[model samples]
Target: MDPLILGALVAVATIAVLFSGVSVATGLLIVSGLFLVLFEGMWALELMPDKFFGKLNSFALLSIPMFIIMGSAISSTRAGADLYEALERWLTRVPGGLVMSNLGACALFSAMSGSSPATCAAIGKMGIPEMRKRGYPEEVAAGSIAAGGTLGILIPPSVTMIVYGIATETSIGRLFLAGVLPGLMLVGLFMVWSVYSTWRNTGLSVMSARSYSLREKLEILPRVIPFLLVIVGVLYAMYGGIATPSETAAVGALLCLLMAIVIYRMWSPKSLWVVLRDSTRESVMILFIIGAAGVFSYMLSSLFITQSIAMWISDLDVNRWVLLGAVNVFLLIAGFFLPPVAVILMAAPILLPIILAADFDPYWFAVILTINMEIGLISPPVGLNLYVISSIAPDIKLKTILKGSMPYVGCMVLAIVILCVFPGIATWLPDLVMGPVR
Candidate 1:
């Protein structure tokens, strides 16, 4: 079969299987095995073990589990609650501050967790109920937290960015550094929308139930500030050449667990079990997808489909920006149905060469792709964050959550436009710190 036609068929089949409710890892594995047998012959099966171990055997990949463990530790405790409570105490006097606190907490928690669902569950469970109690609209409370949670994959320690670095053979540290500004930019954008929406609706501020004294506010910081410092230290370690991501993740995970234990009294056996169990489940899920994607990538390359597609796109007589817009549309569609990590694993490889061919910086494109994934988290049919929020705040109907989330979705789209206009927002930090991708 012609490689182009075969590639098209494989893509359609993969999509069909995934949308048919097959697990992503299983769908990719089944597709890879069937194709290898029919085309490469059954002997290809012999090489599968090496492929699995080869992809699974990365030291950098070890960071995924460590970071998951870090996120899960705090998430399984009152740390998220403490973080939001502190923010609420400080921001309560400001208009729309309750919503602001959720977005802010989500961003900070995301910096620690690096998993969108984890971020949402950790922050949303506390943030949403409190927002409702303070009289913020269900949409504002649910929408902002859901949107803020998407920041996990765009922030430092992001599993999605790590996966991208691994797939494209780019520097994971640089990728982590690159995401910093764009992630903050999204948070700021989301905050702006939250404030404006709240102001427009009623100017009815969601103040704290009672005023907080200076001492009261100061006390909350001891619990929250250490976690913030841990985030800063981990970022510094990666950027300042103090540690590899895996090393930073290991230390960060240990510190977060210790904090949860001492600060929140989460050292009990069941509490420890929840942290480890969640870490294992989520880590296994992501790593399994990575392994399967490796085989899928190998099959595409071996069959010449990857080359054929890149060649075809290179032959186009269109403007590079136009080509970029087309790629964004493709990503938007893919992200609408697939989880961000899976989307990154499958599409980032296919898109990287084309992006580089169009004179785009890989790191800048990482931000753009991550923002697309953010849109996916709030979108329906397969919006994992949507489901997460639903489970967290079941009283808020899905439609209400979707309605609240749409404006933040618009903010993400605007953030993408802003980054496109000034690509430096994504590239400047990494370039200055790392001395330009070299």
Candidate 2:
């Protein structure tokens, strides 16, 4: 069979299997296995073990579980709840203050968590109910938190970035540094939109049930100082040359554990077991998917499909900007159905060559792709973050959550445009701190 035809068959089969509700790891494994047998025969099976270990044996990827443990440990505490309560106390007097608080909390939590659904679920569980109690619109409350939660993947220490860096052979530290500005930019954009939306419509504002004095407001910091310390400590360790990204994650996890046990006094044997179990489960799921994706990626390279696609696109002689725009649009559409990691793993092999051929900075393109995938987390059909928020606030229908996320989707698109026009927004911090990767 022609390699292109084989590629098309694999793509269609994978999509069909995924739509049939198979897990991504399962679908990719099944599809890749069948194609390998059909095309390459039994001898290729000999390579599977090496491939699995190769994918799992990354020092940098070790951070996924450590960061996950950190996030889970913190989730077990009152950290998220206290952080939001403090924000509410301070911001309730401002327009769309509660919504802003929700976005702020999500960004702060994203800095710690590195997982979209985790951030969405943790913040949404606290923010949505309180927003409802304060007479805030359900759609606004749900939408903003869902959208804000997508920040988890774009920010530094992001699991998605870790995966992308390892897959692309980019410097993981540089990738982490590169994401900082764009992540903060998205946070500002989301918050600005929230405030503007509330201001134009006075109906969105609600009087606080009680007010806080300066002393009380200042005291709120103690409740959240531990989390802030973890974020700062992790970033400083990585950027200040004290630790690798993976080591920073381990240290951060340890800090989060100590904070949960010593400071918050929320850690018990049972709770620690639960956090470890949940972190293990999530880490295993991600690694399994990456292992499966490694098989599919190997098959693509063997078939020369990635190189073929890149050559075909280059031969079209299309303007590079037009090609770039089209790639973004394709990724945006694909995001609605595929999770970000799947999209990155599946698409990067094919797309990155064409991007590099166009003379685009790999690091900048990574940030752009991260932003696009983040939008997908809240998009419908397979919007994981939307489902997470819905599960947390059972009263808010999925459709309402989906509807609410659209405006923030616009904010993401605008951020993409800004990044495109000024690549420095994504590249500057990394360039200043670590120098360029490419």
Candidate 3:
């Protein structure tokens, strides 16, 4: 069989299985396995080496489990509720203040958790009800939570960044550092949009002026300060060369455990057990997907599809900007149908070559690709964030969530454009902090 035909068949089969409601992991694994057997014959079985399993046994990948454990421990301990309570006391005085606070809390939680679903589940539970009780529209409340949840992947210690770094062999520390400025930029954009949207509606009420004495505000900081410390500590260690990215994750995880146990006193053996078990489960799922993706990527490389695509892309008589735009459009369409991880897995292999061939900055392209995937999280038909929000508020129509998410989506597009035009915005911090890329 022509390798290209085989590649197309594998792609179609994966999608067909996904649409048929089979588990994504199972679908990916089965499709890859079948392709190997069918295309490569019996020798394909023999070619499945021990090193394939060994690839998952990386010390760097250890960060995934540690971060997941930390996230679960934090989520299970009701730490998010404390953070929100502390934030609400301070921010609730402004118009749509609670929503702003929700974004703020989500940003903090995203730094800690690094998973969108966990962020959504943690913050949405509290934010949605509070917004509704405060007379905010359901669409606005749900949209804020869903959009805010996306911060998880953009912030440092992000699992997505870690995965990207690992897959591409880019510096994980640099990738983490790269995310900070862009992440904060997105947060600011979301806040501005949230404020503007609430202002335009006029149906929502702002908090009445209730003075909090200096002492009261000071009191809340004690609760909030620890979260900030954890983030700062991790970044400081990484930036100062005190620890590698994996080591920073370990230290951060230990601090998270201590915060939950000693400071909050929410840790029990049972709770700790649950956190470990849940983290293990989630980590296994991620690793499996990654492993299967590795296999598929290997198969694609074996078939020369990546080379073919890169060659074809290079042959096109287009300027760099046009090529970048084409890549964005392709990723956007992929996002509508594929999970972010899958999109990253499939597209990164093909596109990275094209990017390198075109002399594009890898870090800039990574940020651009990440932002595109983030937008996909809110896009129609299959936006993961939309489904997450819908699951929380079943009565709220998907259309409302779609409409509400548009502003944030627009904000994301604007951010992407800024990064494209001013690659320095994404690259400057990384270069300054990481020093000139070798």
lDDT of each prediction vs. the true structure? 0.88, 0.85, 0.80
lDDT tens digits, residue span 93-114, model 3: 8777888889999899877877
On TM-score, the leading prediction is 1
Q: Predicted candidate 2: what Cα RMSD to the true structure?
A: 1.7
Relative to the unseen true structure, what is the C-alpha lDDT of residue 326 in candidate 3, on a scale of 0 to 100? Answer: 91
Give me candidate 2's TM-score against the actual structure: 0.95
What tens-digit string does per-residue lDDT give for candidate 2 at 1-438?
A: 666777788788888998998999888888877877778898888887688678888888888899899888888777877888888889877767888889989988876777677788778888888887877777788999999888888887788888888778788888888898999999999988876665565565564557778988899898798789888888898889998888999999988998899878865789889999999999998899889888889888887777777778899878999999999999999898988888888888788889999999888999999999988888877788888998999988888888888989999999999998999998898889987664
Query: Of 2 and 3, which scores higher on TM-score?
Result: 2
Model 1 worst lDDT run, 10 consecutive residues: 201-210
Q: On residues 217-317, what C-alpha lDDT tens digit does candidate 1 reach at each position?
A: 99989988888898889988888889899999999999999988988888589889988998999899999999999988888887899999999999999
Estimate candidate 1's RMSD in Å.
Answer: 1.5
Ranking of all candidate structures by their TM-score, best first = 1, 2, 3
Q: CA shift at 240, candidate 3, in angstroms?
A: 1.2
Instruction: Quote the lDDT for 299 in model 1.
Output: 81
Question: In model 2, what is the error at residue 296, expressed in angstroms?
Answer: 1.0
Please list all clashing residue pairs in model 3, or write none if there are none.
none
Ranking by lDDT: 1, 2, 3
**Structural similarity to truth (TM-score) of each candidate:** 0.97, 0.95, 0.94
Pick out the ten consecutive residues of candidate 3 with the lowest summed lDDT. Answer: 46-55
lDDT, model 3, position 139: 66
